[model samples]
Target: MSALPNNPPPNVSKDAVARSLAEAHRLTDPEITMIFRIEKPGQESNPAEPVKLLEVNPNTTASGIMPVKLMPHAPSGIFFPSVIVEVHPTELEDLKNGNLLLPNGWKVNYDRPL
Candidate 1:
């Protein structure tokens, strides 16, 4: 018996490849930013404040910063993206106090464990 071709069947639509390329291009562009709201335990969501587009560490044991405007005024909890910076509580506190300065018009929001 003849061996089947390694590639996809010829019946597949050519538009499929084009569509996939378009999607990949969109994902690669830096203009896309995913926003995730922070949620506290026992609470469905934070009504007073909400954190969006938070950056988090890899080990799931650290917190990071985001734009001040995007951060909540009275944050109950904070959410972050899968990739974040790993920092100690003390360091986070220092950052809050303005000791750690970021670029102009930028602020650091700590996502500590409650």
Candidate 2:
């Protein structure tokens, strides 16, 4: 489990994360699945929530992009900030090019390992 610098708003829910991941994965690849595990709050001792990289889809998309997700082992009472998982280098580029869509008020991080 890793730590995120920002925590998600209270309104954020696990279902939302699952749904978003599912949708994102579907857009990137149908066979991709996401696993999320949230870290305990107050654990980071900062505003950031820690998120870990659990798994990635084995199947690659036409652009050689793999679907990725943040899996937290245990979530605290609060929802942490949004973390972006980039399977390929171009994915980030696509995001910058407005080729991809993401939820509002969500922050994108390209630091996740491929």
Model number with the top TM-score: 2
Name the runs in model 2 displaced over 4 angstroms: 1-8, 33-47, 50-53, 60-114
lDDT of 2 by residue, 9-79 (tens): 66755445544554554676665454333234344334444332222344534253233344342353324
**Candidate 1 lDDT by residue in tens digits, 30-52:** 34222222233332222322222
lDDT, candidate 1, at 8? 35
lDDT of 2 at 15: 43
- RMSD in order of candidates: 19.2, 11.3
C-alpha lDDT values of all predictions:
0.32, 0.42
Clashes of 2: 12
Please list all clashing residue pairs in model 1, or write none if there are none.
Answer: 56-83, 56-84, 57-84
